[model samples]
Target: MRSPAAGVPDPTSAALWGLPLWLWVVLGGIGLFGVFQVYYWVGHRLGSRLYASRLGRRLGQDNIRRVENAVRRWGALAVYGCFWVPGLRHTLPWTAGVLRISYPWYVVASALGCLTWVPVTSFGLYSMIWGWLRLAARSPALAAGVAVVVVAAVAVLVLRRRRRRRREAERRPEDTLTTA
Candidate 1:
């Protein structure tokens, strides 16, 4: 699942069945672009209803206003950057649509954002997963031992933190003033 380049795994670059890396990248990128476009359209189409609905209320008007301001100030650049942020990824595209940003700008910015994101995620996943597999293959016991040590270290840190918190709580001074 790695690219021709050594030590770099690119799932999109990896051929499936009889496919090739370039094809995979192209198809995957297209698919990602389509998805973002759909997201933008949905926002455009249902902008008012979605924003006024219970779900929208839950998202908070203040937060929505902030995002709107960001889009107004930065325009397509905000949408482009939002492709990488989790909640914003969902919100920004729709916001762009709600605000009626130029369609051309939306397409270009969103496409460019997807171009950057899809490959990175695809390649990074492949590298990490395959790399771990290779390491485990080479040293199963060592891998297991390292995992155990990491878990033990985390547990020790948690327990120490709890103990410290308890000691601090016990040392807190009591309030001397009483309410009338």
Candidate 2:
């Protein structure tokens, strides 16, 4: 793949002020953290109405209720765990707000979750981008082939994992013992 910038070979080198690209990545992640905090605040303010909206109904009242129960049971830890899950990320914070988790606890949990999530995401992105740039520089065709293979492998693995989980779920009832 060709670099977007004609003259500039390495887009990563493009930076604001004197700071390196990775610093900016970290800052962006922190910014996302702040945005999510505000998102949580909105959920806090909206409370039940937010959950009663069309989108919320789509998310399923039972599901939201389950999340609410999880929040009540686990407190900040539920927020932390759900922060890493893709679909649940947005909902978890809002649920935390509806549960009226302490402001300080929410902040601490958010900070801790972001600390783990942001750095890993930034590093993974940096690595993948650089790896692709290097591969494409050597041979664009090879890079494209490699990208396809990686995506296919990931898809297969996810499908297999889901199938295995479904099988386990199916067997659970039969696996239980019955009293005479």
Candidate 1 residue-wise lDDT, 1-180, digit = tens: 555666655555566679875677678889878887887788789876777766566555656888899999999999889977877987778778888888899999988988898778776776666676777788998777767887899999999978975665456533122348
Where is model 1 more than 4 Å wrong at Cα? 1-13, 141-180
Candidate 2 wrongly placed segments (more than 4 Å): 1-19, 150-180
Give the root-mean-square deviation of each candidate in angstroms.
9.2, 8.5
Q: After superposition, how far is residue 6 of candidate 2 from its true place, in Å?
A: 26
Query: Against the correct fold, how does model 2 do in TM-score?
Result: 0.69
Task: Give TM-scores for every candidate, taking all chains together and pairing residue i with residue i.
Answer: 0.67, 0.69
Q: What is the alpha-carbon lDDT of model 1 when measured against the actual structure?
A: 0.77
Name the weakest run of 10 consecutive residues (lDDT summed) in model 2: 169-178
- Which is the leading candidate under TM-score? 2
Residue range 1-180, candidate 2, lDDT tens digits: 346765334646645579876688779768878977986898889998988777676566666888889889999888788768877788889888877898888888888888888878776777688789878998999999999999999999999978976676466655333459
